[model samples]
Structures are given as C-alpha cells and as structure tokens.
Target chain A: MSEVVSALAGARASGMVELADAGATGMITLRGDHALLGAAVQAVLGLAMPEVRRVVAGEGAQVLWMSPDELLVITGYDVAPGLAADLQSALGDAFATVAVVSDARALIRLSGAQARDVLAKLCPVDFADFPVGALRRTRAAQVAAAVWRTSDSDWSLICFRSVAGYVWEALVTVAQPGGEVALYR
Target chain B: MLLLTCPCCGVTAEETEFANGGEAHLKRFGPGSDDADYEAYMFARKNPRGVHFERWRHIYGCGKWFLMARCTMTLEVFGTYRAQTSEPPAEIVAKIKARRPEWEGF
Candidate 1:
C-alpha cells in the first residue's frame, strides 16, 4: 500500500502561528435522527452526541456535531475503516447512513496567539464568541470548511483534500512575519 | 448580505452559508389539474414587494432547509422557521403584523 503524506509536508511556517497537519486522522460521516444517532454513537464510540455546533471528546476520539442530524467522528486514521464498519453493524437499520471519509479531507491544526487572526482573514465568524468546543461549518478562504476551537489558543480546520494546498498557502502567506492578514486583529 | 438563522442548527449564519430556494409554500398542481392551473402552479409566483416568505437552505451550516420571512423592499428579516412546516408559523405571522400593520397574513 502506498503511504499517505500530509498536504503540508515541506511547507514553511511563519513562526507566529504554528501550523501542523493532523496526519492521517480518521474521519467518519454519519446522518440520521438525533435520538437514534446519539444512541448509536454512544454505543459505538463511548461518547455523547455533542450539541449542535459542539464537540464531545473522549479517549483518543472526538465527535463533532456538524448539524442537527449529522456528525463527524475523528479518530486514528488506521482505525477509521474498522470503526466505521463497527458503527454500521452496531447501528444496523437504526440510523440513516454512515460513511468513512478519512481520505476525503485534510485536518489542519493552527495554534499560537495569532491563530484567531489568521482564521479571521478567511471567514466572517466572530472567533471571540467561538468558545472552546464550538464548531462552525463555513467557508475558509473561499473553500468549504469546518472550524473548531480546541483550546484557548488552538483551533482545528477541516477542508477538502483537493484544496488543502491552497488553504495551506493562504495560511502561510497570512502568517508570515508582519503578514498583511494580521490586520484583522 | 442577508443574515438568516437555521432553526435546525440554531446558527445565525451569513448569506454565504445559505442557498436561496425561491418562494415558499408553493402548492403543487399535479396530473388531472387544468392546464391553466398547472401553468399557474409552475409559473405564477406572488412577487410581493413586502413581507415575502421564501425557502432557504443552510447549505454550509446545518444542511437543513428553512423558511425566512423577509421584506423584499427593505431586506428586513422578520424571522426563520423550520422547513417541515407547510405554512408559516402563527407567531412569525404575528410578528410581521406587529411590524407592518398594513401587511396581511400568508
């Protein structure tokens, strides 16, 4: 099997903001009724179904509520296919649908004091109100993306793998020393 | 830029996060209906200048369809409601009436 490489490998970072690829993270997409889906998630992932636009974290896993009826499961990349299958069988005929989308997206982690400033350059969401665990499905520098605050100064951005290169370049250009994008701060 | 809230996800996102879905509460005139009635159903739309009810999708947010009561003239949003409803909610109609006294219910 050919090894998967991160889209940001060999990319230069501006230092003001630490950019790292959350390498080979597993991702699964699920959609169904809230109650049934929540129950299945709890049974399979041992985590609660997060509130709308929120995240529930467990040991080595995170469940992000993408919508009222949709959720994104994050875990180790190698474990994604098996986890998705396990969830499918556990929730057989109970939920609407489940799919493993691990290879379809690139997960990027941005941290440092200037992280918020860099994100602000891409989307119109008010980061001040985006407290920890808050997730927002919006555009990032013109690409469809979902952003969530992991901690006080850390954020995770997920976007299509195809545009990962563009997104990385945009972030790097904005994070450069005295980078013009920081004006948003 | 219209800012509307998705009732499903409770996210008040910008227009960029939504996709406009034209008029709401459209009644379908299927087979056996008169030609005129079918034409009206397919073509005729009440493009009222004020207090318009329309369908909107929170495509980038919740991926749920919703209804928005807006003013075409002033671009003022009256409110948003779930798309599963066949008609506008009574409370939203009351709000519009309170704001625009000359307006009629949908």
Candidate 2:
C-alpha cells in the first residue's frame, strides 16, 4: 500500500493570521440510524453523539454530526484503521456503514486575532454568531469546508484532500497583512 | 439571497449553500410508464406565481434534501419541512392557505 501524505505537507505562512497544514488527521465516516449510531459510536470512541449540526468531544476523540444519517469521527491517524473495524463490529449486522476517510481530507489550522476576519472573507457564515465549539459546513471561496472555532483567536478547518491546496492558498492570501476588515475583530 | 434551513439537520444558511431540486411533490414515472406521464414527470413543472413548494438540497451543509414552501413572486418563505413525506405537512399547508386565501391547494 502507498504511504499517505498531506496535500500541503505541513506548509505554513505567517500573516495577519497563521495558516498552516494541521497535517493528516484520521477520519471515519459512519452512516446509520440514530439509535444504532449512538450505540456504535459510544462503544468505539466513547464519545457522545453530537446534536444536529454539532460537534461533541470525549476522551481523545471528536464526533461531528454530518447529517441525520451520517457522522464524522476524528481520532489519531494510526488508530483510525483499527477503530473503523471496531466500529463496524459494534454496529453488528445492523443497517450501517463505516469507512476510513482520513486519506480523503486535510486539516488546516488558522490562529491569530485576525483569524475570524480572514475566514469571514471567504465563507458566507455569520462569524459573529459562530461561537467556540459551533461547527459550520460551507464553502471557503469555491471549495466545500467544515470549520470550527477552537477559541476566540483560533480556528480549524477540514476540506477534501483534492482542494486542500486551494484552501491553503486562499487562507494565506486573505490572511495577508492589512487585509483585515476588523469586522470580526 | 434566500435563506433556507435544512429540516433534517436544522442548519439555516444562505441560498448559496443549497441546490434547488425543482418543484416538490413530483410524481415520478419510471419503467413501463406511459409517454405522457414520463414527459410530464421529466419536464412539466408548476410555475405558480404565488405560493409554491419546492425541494432543496443542503449541498454544503448536512447534504440532506428538504422541502420549502414559499411565494414565487416575493420569495417569502412560509416554512420548510422534511423531504421524507409524500406531501407537505398539514401545518405548512394550512399556513400557506391562511396567507393566500385564494391560492390553489397543494
């Protein structure tokens, strides 16, 4: 099997906001009914099922409710393969699916006082109401993305691996000094 | 810009985040169907000037399909509901009826 690699290979840029590849984080996609998914996720990640369009954290893992029938599990890259198998086993013949999607995405971290301003320029989400722990899935410019605020000055984003390069460049350009709109500052 | 919400996930976002799936409650014609039925299913649409129900996909959000009832002329959204049902929910239909007294039923 070929070795997995991040799209940007840990590229970093220092501007009004710090934009860098957060590296290849493991991701597993689970699809099932609520009762079944809740049990399966708890048995495997020990994380509570997140509310609709929400994110829940527990122990060392995070569960994101991607849709009514879908969830995105975030965990260590090395453990993802094994965990996916475990999740499937936990589901146990019920109507559901679990697949490793770590290689299908790339993570980016944007942190600084101006991080919000940079992201607000590209995505259409209302940043003022987007508090910490709130998750939003929208387009950053043209590429689809799911973003969450870790703190007032820090943000994390994940997008398809194919568009990771574009997301990085877009963030870098918008993070340029003096580009700050200060609307979100 | 139209601000729509996905009933499945409860994400209210701008119209750009959704993909319009055309008029809602469409009766699909599959294999062995008559030519007229198939043609109507394929191309015919209700271009009502006032109240309307249409399907929308939260393409950038939850990626779920939902139905929205709104006025075609003003784009005033009446309500949005899950796409699982074969017809608009009674409450939404009633709301539309109350607002547009002369409007035809869904």
Candidate 3:
C-alpha cells in the first residue's frame, strides 16, 4: 500500500494568522436529491442535512451544503475510503453521484485574530458579517476554495490538491507578520 | 460590480463570483429539428437594450446554473430563478413589463 502523504507534510506557519495542514482529511462530493442525502448523511455522520451555504459540523465530521443539489461531506481520512459503501447502502436504490474526493483536495486551517483578514485578502467574501458555521465557496486568489469558520477566531479552507503548495504559500504570504489588514478586528 | 443573487443557494455575490453563460431559455434543437430551428438555436441571441435574459453559473459559490432577468442598458437586475425553469416566472415577467413597457415578450 502506498503511504498516504498529505499535499504538504503537515506544513505549519504563524504570521498574521496561524496556518497548518488539516492532515489528510476525507471528503465526499454528493450530487443528487436531498431525499437520498438526508438518509445517507444521517446514517454516516448522525447529523441533519445542512441548509444552503451552511455547514453542519459534528465531532470529527462536517456536512456542508455545496449547492442546491450538491453536498460535500468532510470526515477523518481513514473513515472516508469506506464511507462510500456505507453511504451507497444508506441511499438504497435511489439515484445519486457519490464520490470519495478526499485525495483530490487539500485542507488548511487558519486561526488567530487575523485569520479572517488572511481569507478576506484572497477571497472576495464579506468576512465582517460572516458568522460561524457559514460556508463560503469562493475564489481564493486565482483558485477556487471552500471556506468555513470553525470558531470566532479560527477558519478552515479547502482547495484543489494540485494547488495545495501554491495555496499554502499564498495563505502564508498574505498573512505576513506586518500585513495585518485589521478590518475584521 | 454586479451583485447577482442565486436562487439555488440564495447567495448574492459579485459578478466575478458568478460566470455569465450567454443568453438563457434557449430551446435546444435536436436531430429531428428543422434547419431553421437549429440555426436560431445556434446563432440567434437576444441583445435587447432594455430587458435581457441570461444564463449564469454560480461558479464559485453553489456551482448551480440559474437564469437572470435584467436590463441590458441600466444593468439593473429584475430577478433570478433556477435553471430548470423553462420560462421566466409570471411575477418576474410582470416586473419587467411594468418597468419597461416597450420590451418585447420573451
């Protein structure tokens, strides 16, 4: 078996905000009717379906509303590979596209008081009014990213694995020690 | 600088966040369709100065395709609806009619 290595081997940095790899997280992109998702989500994560643009985080799992007909399920890396079978069984004979896309993406965490500023600089989202648990899927610099608040001072961001190195550096660069925007504070 | 709302996810974001996918409500022609119908579907597009209908993908947000009714001149948006809808809903059509009385019917 190939050793599952994260895009960045647990890269960590602290500047305007704290940046760190979210390990080799597991992600599932579900595109189908909510009737099937509700059952699968309930069975897999024991959480209710999230509303549009909202993220439901529980324990070590999170269910994010990616669109009207799409949901992104995030869980621990090891638990992700086997989750497809479990989700398919829960979906029964219903039609849906369930894909285990953990390896296709990279997760990074930004914490500290200036974390929001770090995200705001790269992404065009209204961070001033952004509340916790609200998911914002927008462009981060030149790449697409899904962002959510884990706490008042902490944020989580997921982008394509191919751009992990660039995204990591971008996050770190935007969050330079003296580059604090101080807008969200 | 346009802040278009997405009916699917209900997120009103900048124009950069969404992608403009040309004209909306196009009746796709198939193999059995006449040449004229195919030509209209392929090349004919509405470029009205007053009211315009367009297809936009909320590429950065919900990743859903939706239709928008807006004024091509003023850049004022009338409304947005799901892409599954074949035509503009009654309320939106009425709104455009009331605002721009000379607009041709969709």
Query: Measured with DockQ on alpha carbons, how good is candidate 1?
Result: 0.73
User: How well is each residue in A1-185 modelled by candidate 1, as lDDT tens digits?
Assistant: 99876655534465669988887789999888878778888999899989878999889889999987788999998898998998888888784789999888889899888888888888868776778998999888787899999998899999999999998888877777776455435
DockQ-derived CAPRI band for the predicted complex in model 2: medium
In model 3, state the lDDT of residue B82: 82
Assess the local accuracy of residue B59 in candidate 2 as a C-alpha lDDT between 0 and 100. Answer: 92
Candidate 1 share of real interface contacts: 0.72
Mark the 10 consecutive residues where model 2 chain A has the least summed lDDT: A51-60
Model 3 Cα lDDT, one tens digit per residue, B1-106: 7889888888778899999999999889988899999999999887877888999999988788899999888899988988888999999999999988887788
Instruction: Show model 1 residue runs off by greater than 4 Å.
Output: A7-12, A180-185
Task: Name the docking class for model 3.
Answer: medium
* C-alpha lDDT (0 to 100) for residue B15 of candidate 2: 95
lDDT of 2 at A134: 77
Model 2: CA > 4 A from native = none
Q: What is the lDDT of candidate 1?
A: 0.86
Taken over the whole model, the C-alpha lDDT of each candidate is 0.86, 0.88, 0.88
Q: Estimate each model's TM-score.
A: 0.94, 0.94, 0.94
Q: Candidate 3, which segments miss by more than 4 Å at Cα?
A: none
Candidate 3: Cα lDDT at A127: 90
